[model samples]
Structures are given as structure tokens and as C-alpha cells.
Target: MSIKGQTEQQQAEAQLAVGYYTELFKPPLEPKKLPPPAKLPPVPQPVLAQRVPGAKEESVSGAWQIVADKLKEQILLRHYSPQTLKSYSIWMWKLSRFLENKSPETVTTSDVQRFLADLAVRQQVSASAQNQAFHALLFLFRYVFKRDLGDLRDTPRARFQLASFPFRD
Candidate 1:
């Protein structure tokens, strides 16, 4: 337009025309503040497992505590892995809970069977977990309590679902 000798007024007008059309085509601005988020119901906090009457304080109270300590000692003496120690200890605690802090000496194979059944039927634990719990209890009975927990009868086994494999060409 300058080379063709258009006036300064003419060039300004042309730019203003383009600007007007751009403004007309432009999308409207989003609201600065979204309507205050919908009022939400208060979320409930998770309830922790309530402690059994005699389960707390491993020393001076629970008889299971003494057996638990012995189990730990035996596990350590055998140079078992930390994971093994933790799992065994956890299973022992669970047994204590199941028994309502009763003496481990009184726990027969039937009790173990019931606990394992609860894991499978009630708690719905996986195959490996149920097996791990079984082995842990086995160790506790055989070594710690010095009782033979022979043949846990009527024990519910955890059902493992195997994934179907694809055939290769």
C-alpha cells in the first residue's frame, strides 16, 4: 500500500477493519470464578482395628507375647530374612487376635483350621497369603510352642485363578 501510494489514513482504516472482524470472531472469556464447588458431605475417617483386652503390651500381660518373643528369637537364630520375621510375627499377632489373647498352648489343629478357613472364606485372602499364614502358624506350633500341629482338617484353601495363556504361531 505504501509503494502504491496509499495514504496513512487508508492503511490505518484497513488495519482497524481486520481488528474489528477478529474481535467479532473471538470466543467469549471463561468465567473468572466457577460457581463455588458443590457442597460435599464430610468424608468419614477410617476406623482402626480395636485392640483386644489382653493383646497390648508384649511384656507382663499377654502369654502370647512370651511365645511371640520366642518365635522372634528362633527366627533370628536361624538367620531367617527380615520379611520372614515380619510375616511370622504378624501371623502370631493375628492368631492372638483370633484367640482373644488365649494361651497358645491351648490352640489345637482345629483352631488353626478355623483361622485358615476364616482367611479363605471370610477374609478372602489370596492363595499365597493363606499359604504364608499356614506356614507361619506351622512354624509357631512345631518350634515355638513345641507342639505338633498335625494335619489341619476342614481347612479352606485359597482359590487361585490362573490366567489363560495365548497360543503362539
Candidate 2:
């Protein structure tokens, strides 16, 4: 065939090939529509002022209650462990009970000394327990109540009696 006729035939074949490929590659059908997003219940907002430990103490009238709330605030503000908060709160309760629920403002170093002495001499708590109580009180006085604990020299020490345990390898 002539070059002109061959070129026309080649163009027609190219068109057919392109049409075949387009039909082969075409998408099958329309996709399924997506479901609408589910609506969620509204969340309640927290009361910012009441969330603070100090603000929650408003209804508490006792001196120790106010002091305890302050202690909790300090412990939380410093990011101390929850165990520390629990221990300190326990010791504070014990101290209040020991003082016959006296005002925290009126408690002095002597009061603390008596409490510690009672733990050692009367309650017979272990040295570690006594030390734990001491630290709790220390944090209370120095940080919470903002008072000096003074020298704790007069505080009685809890004596320890070691017991030997038999072991075999």
C-alpha cells in the first residue's frame, strides 16, 4: 500500500487500541455512600474553683480541716506521690486526735514532741513507722502550716530488737 493509505490505516488501528484499553481499565460501578457520623452526648464541664483542694474546704470550719486542705493542696501542687498524700493525711488525723482536736495554730513543738514520744513509749511503733510519722509531721509543719518544727531532740526513739532467722542454702 501507499505511504498515505498505510498512515491512515495505522491511525485507525491506534484509535481502536486506545478505545479497547479505555474500556478494559474503566471502573466497575458507583461506590456505596458512607454512613452519616454518629452524634455523641455532650460532656459536662468541671468547676475550676471547686476542683482545687483549698476551695473545697470552704464548708469545713475546723482549724485542722483547713490545715489539712492546705496540706493536700501543697502535696498535689508539688506532684508528690499519692502514697505521700495518704501517709501525711493519716499522720495529720493522728495528731489531731492526740491533741484532743486542738487548733492546728496552737500546736507547738512540745505538742509534736509529746505525740512522737507517745508513739515510741506508749504505742511501741516500729522505728520506721515512727520515722514515717515524723516526716509527715515535718511536711505538715514546714510546708502546710508554715511553722518551725524546732529541734526534735526531745522526741523519744522507738527501740528495735533484732530477731535472728535460720536459713539453709
Candidate 3:
């Protein structure tokens, strides 16, 4: 009621908080004291969603340069860094060529696995690079190519790594 009666913060808080609570439903449950939620770094969304549909289409002159080109365009239009466009384009180009200038629909899933294996064994690329190429190719099929890559039967199995058992000694 008077300036002497309460601190200004308390008075302001009281004024702001007035009539904020209801008396009609007081206590069937105790007020829950929840710990403040942990501050979490936002989960980065999957990058594959950036692929644009209707961009990839059949090539009139040859295999679809436009599909791979448009994917580059879409990537640029979305302002993705230049590095992503470079990496994706490299894989896209290789895959389209690997299909031997055929329509995407004409290609089978086995072709992809074969390509990867050949890239590893024949081309002598590292496993990580093969995996990167595989992911890039997958994004093309799932998003740009817009169809099931169809039971990729040649999935490389987990290779056995030789290790000596400690108990054997």
C-alpha cells in the first residue's frame, strides 16, 4: 500500500503476478518441481532433404546432364557452401556415367553396389571415400532420382577384422 512497505521489485512482481493463479483448483497434486531442462545443442537436420524434386528428368541429347546440373543449381540456390556442391556433383556425375548414359529408371540397384565395390577394389579408393560416394549416390536415387534404389543386393558385408583373443594367450 505504501512505498515503505515493500521493495520495488517485490511490488512490481506482485503487480505483474496478480490474478495469475486460480483458487478453484488448489491441490489434488503437489506442485511438481521439475529440474530445468538441459540445454541441448539443436540436432542438425539431415542434409539429404535439400535435394529438389522435379529437377531431375530424362536427358534428350544423352543421359540427363540437366538432372545433375539442376541438383547443383538447387544446391547453389539454397546457398549451401560451395564444397557440398562440389562433393555431390562429383558423385552424381560418376553415378550417371556409370549407368552408361541410360535413363535412371533403366538402372538397377545392383549397379550402385557394383560401382562402389569397383571404386574400392578396382579403383583402389579408401573405404571412407567409398562410403561418401555411396551416400551421395543414395541421395541422388532417393531424392533427385525419386524411386526405390531397389533392394541393393550387393551391399558390402561387414568385413572380418583379424584380432587375437586375449584369453587365448
Candidate 4:
């Protein structure tokens, strides 16, 4: 073919190629059947009072479990730090043990006082440790139990001990 004829033929071939490519994007005349989406199994929720490894199952069961679950819900709802949740969980567990699994409804300010005193006088925990315990318990009573902790003026205060240095002349 002459150069002009060859260019015309090439343009016609290009047009055909473009038309074929555009057909790929056009909807089919007949509807095609698509398989339904696969059904997924429901996810299991985490148990807040799940058993600790190598520990008795009873340790996390009973009334304490109810309190633990509620405490976790409250902590998560407020968007508190994980450390706060961990600290609160430990204090709640300690409180449960101290109360001998007594129902949270039965817990009183006096009970809290005694527990604080026990931590200070016997456990000899540092002031910061006792304060953290106090705050944890306070959060428990206020949020989890939905009750005010009331007056704790008589609670034995944990004393901060300063390091003593030997005097040199």
C-alpha cells in the first residue's frame, strides 16, 4: 500500500482495537449469577474474669467475677490507660480476697479503712503504693459499685521514709 493508504489502514485497525477494548467495559446482555457471600461464624467475646494460668478456677469466680467484669467495662468505657486497668484489676482482686468474697453491695467504708491500714501497717507498702491502692479502690466503689466511698479520714496513712545519710566531719 502507499504511505497514505497504509496510515489510513493503521488508523482503521486502531479504531477496531479501541472498539474491542471498550466492549469489555460494556454490561453483558444476560445477567450472570454470582455466588452468595460466605457466611462467617460469630466471634466469641473475651471473658473479663478468665482464669489465670496455674491458678485455681475458683479464684476468679463467684461475686468477684461480677465486680471484675463491671470494673473492666467501666475502665474501657472511660478510655483509661491499660496500666490503669491493670492496677485497678490487681486492687480489686486484693479487695476481693480481703473481703473473703463478700458481695460488693456489703462492702462499707470501714472495710476499706481496715484494708488500707492493713496495707500500711502490715504489708509496709510504700506511700505511693498505698495511694495507688486507695485510688483504685475509690474508682471501684464510685464506678463499679456505683456508690461513694464516704469519709476515710481515719484510714491509716502510709508514711514515706526518707533515706538517712551518715554524717561525716
In TM-score terms, candidate 1 sits at 0.62
TM-score of each: 0.62, 0.61, 0.50, 0.62
Q: List ranges where model 3 is wrong by over 4 Å.
A: 1-62, 77-79, 157-169
How displaced is residue 78 in candidate 3, in Å? Answer: 5.6
- Model 4 lDDT per residue over 118-155, tens place: 99999989999999999999999989888999999988
| Whole-model Cα lDDT of every candidate shown, in order | 0.76, 0.77, 0.63, 0.79
Clashes of each: 0, 0, 0, 0
Model 2 over residues 1-169: C-alpha lDDT tens digits?
Answer: 6556677779889789999999998987988788996532221121222223553233332566678778878887898877787778888878877766666777899999999999999999988899999999999999988888999996789987474345678
In candidate 4, which residue pairs get closer than 3 Å at backbone N, Cα or C atoms, i.e. clash? none
List residue ranges in candidate 4 displaced over 4 A: 1-60, 164-169
RMSD (CA, Å), each prediction: 14.0, 14.9, 13.4, 11.0
Question: Once superposed on the true structure, which residue ranges of model 1 sit more than 4 Å away at CA?
Answer: 1-48, 51-61, 163-169
Instruction: lDDT winner between 2 and 4, please give it.
Output: 4
lDDT of 1: 0.76
lDDT of 1 by residue, 1-169 (tens): 4846988899898889999999998987985676885532221221228743442433323466677678878887887777787778888778777766656667888889989999999998889999999999999998898989988766889898564445678
lDDT of 2: 0.77
Worst 10 residues of 2 by lDDT: 41-50
Estimate, for each residue in 67-138, the C-alpha lDDT of model 3 and write its tens digit.
666666666566766666677777776765665445755666788887877776677666667778877777
